[model samples]
Target: MKWYFVLACYLLAPAIAFCNSYGMGLTNLNLAPTYGKIALFVFSSLVGSDGGVIAGLAACGIIMSIVCSAADLMQDFKSSYLTLSSPRSLFVFQMICVAIGCIIAPLALWLFWTAFDIGDPDGEYKAPFAVIFREMAIIGIEGFAALPKHCLEICCVFFLAALIVSLLKDATPSHVSSFIPIPMAMAVPFYIGAYFGVDMFMGTLILFAWQKMNRREADGYAVAAASGLICGDRVWSIPAAVLSILRVDPPICMNFRPTSASV
Candidate 1:
């Protein structure tokens, strides 16, 4: 990891990340982020403490963006393919979006950065993840000795479980395997809560019901309908975030609670 080589990597990282990350999905497992993590940890280990912390932070951010972009692009491509869109056209569209994102993302970040003390531990927001990620880099440099009690063991156990599940899925027949829950997908609920899982289950039920009632119509427009609903819900968050940043509360508030506090 020479300075010159690292510089070259920065120049070619997007292309390299896209290929390795997306190509990995086609080959077997789609652990795009893991590749980025390995690069971060290994690079951190090779550098001194100050350099490791600073460079590792930069590397972690870049790796995350690149790997995440690749995975997201893969999903977009899948949606396009399902909708009978051309790969060439999708690729061109993606490039254009990437160009726009390159400009917009930085400006949005700059706006937020100016508004909030992002890395400050004592700031209003107190970005705890900054400390966590930095600590991860230090651990990379310090080796397993720096890990919390049972952290290494837990990680190893989960890694093996994911591997075995992936193996079983691949070995099983397609009919049977489709029913097999993806380890990565299953892992999401453990950390993020089962609200999303419930949503997926309900969506699946609706789709199945729709197909049973009218298979042809469901096949034709189900994705578009689902995509529109999801996009609409997500798109509202953009303005909601902007309003919050500007310290403007919404005019209306609604909440459903199981119990209300007595006045």
Candidate 2:
């Protein structure tokens, strides 16, 4: 049975490598469902794993695959930081923070859904938040709804917060580690904030234009300009999204801090 499992993983290695090269984490995870089906078939063919035994093994493998994938993601982050010559001490601290951040993700999600009721009305779900609920439902099976809501809220909130801060502040893992609690405080969806950020930036451009024309407005106009900027920024997403699709790989480094001493 053990050898069979090893063989299965070996066969799947090529597929996994291809997915990784494409930077498709979701596609990689999706393969586990197929692997689960294949494992059951193998178990039945080789050792006569009956319904109960087969089901149990399949469940275990699926869980193990998710765990391994998440670990790989962490290692990827660690490698990226090292590639940029981040301090060893800072990297270790950030890893610890990342662990804490992972725990917080689900809890954050539960809270958001509880507060905003943000799910598909027909049960189809979306993203960082959906993952928490979907995994819980799968693992808990019969008792999924009975799971603690706070746990759901934390995880969803934490991951998004990390992504948003990474996007907006250009924070390094070290900076993220130091201000780990901020994401939990305001659980905005990362994409939503990003949209707003674009609008704000555009408004700023308009304001600068007006200022150059000697048409400076009152303080109230400043606030209005800010709002307009946020609205305009969403237009920028079209180009960014297109670029992301063209670029198969996500950028390895983000939120870099430069040395002013170079000046």
Q: Which structure among the candidates has the greatest TM-score?
A: 1
Query: Candidate 2 versus the native: TM-score?
Result: 0.25
lDDT of 1 at 104: 100
Per-model TM against the reference: 0.60, 0.25
**How many residue pairs clash in each candidate at the backbone level?**
0, 30
lDDT of 1 by residue, 56-151 (tens): 666766766776677667877776778788888888888899899999999998998999988777778778877777777787887556658998
lDDT for each candidate structure: 0.73, 0.50
Maximum-lDDT candidate: 1
224 Cα displacement, candidate 2 (Å): 40
In model 2, state the lDDT of residue 84: 70
Location of the lowest summed lDDT over 10 successive residues in candidate 1: 21-30
Off by over 4 Å in 1: 1-42, 45-50, 82-84, 92-132, 135-141, 228-263
